[model samples]
Target: MSRSQRKQEDPDLGVLSSRTLFSLQRELFTKLGEQGHPDLRPRHGAVLAYLDVAGSRATDLATQSGQHKQVIGTLVDELVALGYVERQPDPADRRAKLIVPTEKGLDHMAKSDAILAEMEAEHAKAVGEEAYAEFKRVFRLVAARQAGS
Candidate 1:
């Protein structure tokens, strides 16, 4: 956007980060869904990112996602219905169930990784590789700090 247009829209610069990120995320996921992952949703991204390919449990997902069991359960239910995950009896604790990723889930993860790499390249080109790398470094540091807190 032109400088005057940006200033007119947001003199405080309050909505820039979150609004742009949300818009970029939405566009990326929407295009991805059109490509092949039609069942995925924006809300599913967090829990899905935390999931291990080997296996886990609803409680584990909840812990990793920093969300409640009920919330993770809802996401798991959607994922299960969409054939991305399957629940099987946990061998260690027969009373508990293990949430395992289906082949389709792994496939989607791989595709999403590639798409993110492409996005990184685009960012690098826009701001130069050194700036982009520093940006990512700072982002990771902030995320790690927030995660610790």
Candidate 2:
């Protein structure tokens, strides 16, 4: 069957889209592994992404990530073991510890950005550049609304 025919025959295009996205993420993580950036699971990557952007305390990360503190703590421990993040004393509260991404983590984030950029370029090539930009804008708006809900 033609590729388009197969896609049209699929009952759950949304599910297929989600699976495709998951596979793409796995492929990107595999590339990261080959580069010796530490083997990171999606949960670990989520925490790292959060730290890269917000530089929050563990409790804050747990809350923001909608993960239990113990679970988040375990992920943080793995990150620390991998040398991607470190627990530093929080300046605002000497009793609290802040989870901070290391240089390696920042480097990994840069690599992730490059990967995303490459994907974006592919999308722009497949769909017209203007369509790709519109797709991104609409996706971002929908995502923002979903997050609010």
- Note the Cα lDDT for every prediction shown: 0.82, 0.78
- Error (Å) of candidate 1 at residue 60 is 2.7
Measured by lDDT, the strongest candidate is: 1
Candidate 1's displacement at residue 147, Å, is: 3.0
Residue-level lDDT tens digits of model 1 in 1-149? 99878777766424555676687678778777977898798788756777788888889888877889999888888999999888999889999988888998888777777887888799899999999999889977976887798
Q: State model 1's lDDT.
A: 0.82
Candidate 2 residue 62 Cα shift, in angstroms, is 3.3
Off by over 4 Å in 1: 1-17
- TM for every model, in the order presented, reads 0.80, 0.77
Whole-model lDDT, candidate 2? 0.78
Residue 2 miss distance in model 1 (angstroms): 20
lDDT of 1 at 138: 90
Residue 49 in candidate 1, Cα distance off native in Å: 1.6
